[model samples]
Target: MTFLRDLLGIPGASSDPAALAAAARDRSGADPDGLPLAVVRAEDIDGVRETLRLAHAHHVPVVPRGAGTGLAGGALAGTGAVVLDVSAMDRIVEIDPVDELAVVEPGVLTATLDAAAAEHGLRYAPDPASAAISTIGGNIATNAGGMRCVKYGVTREAVLGLDVVLADGTLVSTGRRTVKGVSGLDLTALFVGSEGTLGVIVGASLRLRALPERTLTAAAGYDDVASAARACGDLARARRDPAMLELLDGLTLDVIDRAQGTDHGRRSRALVIAQADGPAADAEIAAIAEVLGKEASWVEQGVDAASSDALLAARRLALPSIERFGKALIEDICVPRSRLADAFAAVEEIAAEHRVAIYSFAHAGDGNLHPIIGYSGEARPAGVQRAADAIFRLALDLGGTVTGEHGVGLLKRDWLAREVGPDVLGLHASVKAALDPRGILNPGKAL
Candidate 1:
């Protein structure tokens, strides 16, 4: 403790129970093994290096925490670990519109960077639901994707480079500042989704895109989720490219309807919302509405800026809305786009078999479904695990992944082996051994 104070200083580090408790757990509400030794509020990159150097010297595990909004328990600290909270390092170092890149400190919020970029008629495209509060570092760590992922791509694609502090507190830069680079093994990408298991991200260079000239939105309600899923395939087959393609199940709709006093709760089996942005948005939106009419029982224009915001607002409210029922475990499983309907059918069966309430919703274009399981209790109900396992198994069976946006983190580590096979699992271990031989970085997370 004295040695830690020597580097972090008295004010920079705190072992107070309140601080320890806050730092030890994350948004996932996971019960960590125990309280961390302390939390160091790193004010800059040098502070990060000092903290990691202390951690490595003392053989103490370190967990990097951003805004603490991660759902995957990636930031939960192990027993006696030190939580290096990087939120204090917030800074927008540069934004070069000509180069189409923004360099920022790890603690900068995703929305903050976008807001700055918007001033110059540019935008960062990932746009995760928690973008308002989630830090860019966490986004890169999890390779987060949002509704925009259907067109602009995920966090990994938008990330151009990273400055990482490795296990020994050595700051290393990776990747190129330019758009194109194939110089070597993309260590930048390797760290992007590592979920803080290998190094602590100190800074990043992100790709930006010009603002869309126009935008259009549309929504369709189906008698069954299968029809809505089919509509997704239909639009894709028609060579449509929407900025956002989302599917909401009847249950999620019911929650939204109840919360907002809307009529969607009464009859909608599934609702699909799509967005088109750019010069041809109007025509694209019209064509999307036409396709929806072919299979949807209820069709409406999700147009206008206000309406577009409301639509996305409703989608973002899906998780907390369902949590009102009971304790909710949000599961992110991605199946083949064509097999989304089948995955939904399988989820329905699993929920019924387990007698648990599971509400489904997704980025339909990408086949990423969030089947949230809710049950009453502080202790996890047995049926919840069954339902969660069933969803992952179903995804795997359908040639899909166990997780789409959320990293493996603490919850899905076991599923990683099943998803990647023994050989790939072994390779993951090899990489882990190579990068974090001391095992001081984020112990017990992300394989």
Candidate 2:
């Protein structure tokens, strides 16, 4: 308590349940426990530095939180820790339209930054589905990916420079404002997905792209998931890359149709929406449709912005809509593009074997799939656990990762050893020891 007051300059840092509750449960809904000794709302970079120094000296675990929107338990607090809430530091430091770059505080929301970039005819393209509420810091921490990642890349690609506060209160700047540079070791890349295990992110300068002049969209309805998966495989083999390619199974489509009152033009057991920009947009959509025709039940094209947004909104609202049924345990798994069909088939098999309801969706352009297992009542604990284990084991068997975008927070820690061998885990521990020997920064996360 004394450390929090002295370093953060906040009087009530010791007593605040509302703030603690907000920082405790992320989107994961992992059973929240162990209230922090205190919550520190850092207002600026200096404030972050001061808190770290105090924490390092006091040997108290510091859990960094941003908007608490992470699908993983990355933002969940541990026992006897200080919850470092940075959402209060929201601010845009600078925007250079000519250079196509923007400097922003870590607390700024992802959607807010993208909207600001649009004013200059430029945009930051690494948009996770939770862009409306997720923070840039959390995005960087998880190395988030979204629909456009098939073309634009992930959060790590957009980040040009990072201002970080080390465990010992040292402030370090990595990368540059320029387009390219190779001066030293890529420390910036190291911290991007470290999940707050290495340091506290204070500020960042992000790379931006020119806004698209035109966008062409199409929705292809398939007879089954196999058809959609096969179409994705064909596109990859042909080396045809669309700006966005997303898949939604019928179970998910049904939820969206009921919740959002939207229509997909045709009833499809499996659906894929492909989008492209520039003058070749129409051609790209046509080619994607042609490739999907081999197995599609029906195919329709959406040309105007309104229709496109509405179609995309259905895909975006899938999670929330599915949540209406009951609690959903989302599984994010990624396999090699060629093996996507196999992965999809494995998920179906696991659901059948466990007798559980699992709805599937994904950024099919890449092989990142989200398989959500729904639970209706509390009596099915054994069934839910069995389903989760089966799906994760299936992912590992297919040479895919347990988590594609979300970090290995508390929930996925047990799977880490199976995915990466003991030697790699040892290396991770060595690095953690070198940076944070005290283990006072987001302990039990990542490594």
Candidate 3:
């Protein structure tokens, strides 16, 4: 403890019970094996390097953390480990409209970056629901995707370069500021979704987009979730490139209705929300509404900005609204666009078979579903685990990954091998070993 304080300065390190308890868990609902020894709040890149240097020398495990809004248990710290907190490093170093990039610290809030970009007539396209609170470092660690991902892609797509601290506390810069570069091994892409196992991200240069000239939103309601999912596929097949496309199941709509005092569920069992931006925004949404109307019970097109926000609220409020029912174990599974309907059907069957309450929503255009399993009590119900397992298996069966946006933290570690096969899994092990021979950086998580 004294050594850590000396390395990071007194204000940067703490062994306080409250700090340890807060750092011990994330929003994943998985309890930490035990509390961390201490929480070191690193305010700068030098502080991060110093803490890692000490941890490497002492052979102590370190868990690099951002805002703690991660859906997977990637940031959870356990006994004998040090929680390296970087949320205090929030700073937007520069926003270059000429180069269409933003240089930022790892701790900068996702929304803050977008807002700053907006001031320069640009926008940050990745918008995970947690963007309002989630940090860029955490997004990069998990390679998070949001509603806008259907068009702009995920965090990896926005990142132009990174300043990473390796396992041995060696600071290395990978990637470039230009739009395209393939100089070497492409280590930047490798570390983007590594879940902090190989290294800790300290700073990033992010790509930005010009603000759209116009924007429009449209929504449709269906009698069943499968129909709504199919509508998403239909829009994709028709080559309608929407900036955002979201789907909410009946149970999810009900929960949101109760929480927000809206009547979305009463109107239909399912809802599909779509947003189009740029020069042809109006024409694109009209086409989207027409395609949705083929299978939809009701369709609302060209909605006013306020009404569009009201419609989009269902997706933004999904996880929190479901949590109101009870503790929610949110599961992320993505399937091929052609099989989204089949995947949703399997989720319904799994929920019924296990007798658990599962409310699902999706970034439908991308086939990423978030099926939240709600339960009561201090201990997670066995049926909840069963239902979640069944969901993961079905996703694999449908040729989809177990996780779409969220990284395979402690919760999804067991199913990773089954999805990637032994050969690829061995490759993962090889990579981990080469990068972190001592295995002190975020051990026993992503791999």
Candidate 4:
């Protein structure tokens, strides 16, 4: 504690009990292993470097945190660790419309950057549901994906370069501002999704896109989630590339209806919401509606902007709506688009077999599903653990991943080996060893 205070002499340093307790945990709902030694609210790159230097010399573990909105416990601090809170370093350095790029500090909010880009007739493309609150550093750390991922890809795609502070407090810059660069081993991509294990992210150069000329939204009602998933597959088969596509299951719809006082469940057992942007948005949405109409019980297309936002709000409310029931164990699994219906069927089967209620929603265009299991207890039930394991195995069986965008934090660490095999797992350890030989950076998380 004394060491941390001395290292960061800035006013941002704190050892308050309340602040330490709050800094120890993230949104994952998992209890921290123990309280952190201290919380250092870094306001600039020098503060981060100094903190890391002290921690490295003392062999104290350091946890790099952004907005603390991670769902995978990646930011949770453990015993004897130093929590380096970087959210105070929020600054947008530059926005170059001509080059379609933006240079920003890691602590800048995702939505704030997009809003700034919009001022220049451009926009940042990667938008997670928590874009309004989550920091860019956190998104880049997890390589986050959202509904727009179906078209624009994930955070890794938008990042052009990074300024990282290694475990030994060495500052190194990777990548270039130009669109094309193969100057080296693409270390920027490696650090983007490293979950703060290899190094601490201080700054980033991000790619931006021009705002769409036109946009359209469409919604379809189906008798079941399987039907809606099949419709998504049909859209893919027909080569209809929507900017955003989301799906909600019957149980999820019921929860949302109860919370929002809407009759979505009464209207249909499942719902599919989609959006198309750019010059061909109208034609793309028309084709999407035609394909979904084939199996949908009802179809609504070309909705007004306000109505479209209202419809999209339902999808965003899925997680919080279910959380009201109890402690929700949110699971992120993705399968091949062709096997989406099969995956949903397997989820239903698992829920029934385990005698647990599982509400699900999805980024259907990309085949990433969120299966939420709720429980009312101080500790997670054994059945819930079994059900989660079954879901991960099911994803592997269908040629998918245990996690699509959420990185493997403590919750998914054990299953990572099952997904990547022994050889690749060894390679991951080697990389971690090379980057952080002392193993003091965010230990016991990610790999």
| Model 3, span 1-447: residue lDDT tens | 656566446358888889999999998888898889888999788888888888888888999999998888999999989999999999999999999999999999999999999999999999988899999999999999999999999999999999999988899999999999989988999999999999999999999999998778889999999899989999988998898989999999899999889899999999999999898888888998999899999998655678778667778888878777678787899999889889888899999999999898888988898888999887999999999999999999999999999999888888998999899999999999998888988888989
Model 2 root mean square deviation, Cα atoms: 1.8
Q: Is candidate 2 or candidate 3 better by lDDT?
A: 3
Q: State the lDDT of candidate 4 residue by residue for 13-98, as single tens digits.
A: 77788999999999888999789988999989888888888888889999999999998899999778889999998999999999
Ten contiguous residues with the weakest lDDT in model 2: 7-16
lDDT of all predictions: 0.88, 0.84, 0.90, 0.91
Evaluate model 2: give its lDDT: 0.84
* Candidate 3 accuracy as TM-score: 0.97
The positional error of residue 228 in candidate 3, measured at the CA in angstroms, is 1.4
TM-score for candidate 2, please give it. Answer: 0.96
Model 4: lDDT equals 0.91
Q: What are the TM-scores, per candidate, against the unseen true structure?
A: 0.97, 0.96, 0.97, 0.97
Query: Candidate 2 on 341-441: residue-level lDDT in tens?
Result: 88888888888888888888988888899999888864546777788877778778888898889878888888888899899999999989998899988
Residue 115, candidate 1: C-alpha displacement in angstroms: 1.2
Over all chains combined, what TM-score does candidate 1 have? 0.97
- lDDT per residue, candidate 1, 1-447, as tens digits? 566567457347887889888888777857898888889998888888888887788888899999988888999986778899999889999999999899999899999999999999999999888999999999999999998999999999999999999988999999979999999898998998999988999999999999999887888889999999999999988888888899998988898777777777576788898999999999998988888779898887856898877766668778777776677887799988999999888998999999988999999999999898887879988888888998999999999999999888998888988999899988888898898888999988887
lDDT of 3: 0.90
State the number of backbone clashes in model 4.
Answer: 0
lDDT of 1: 0.88
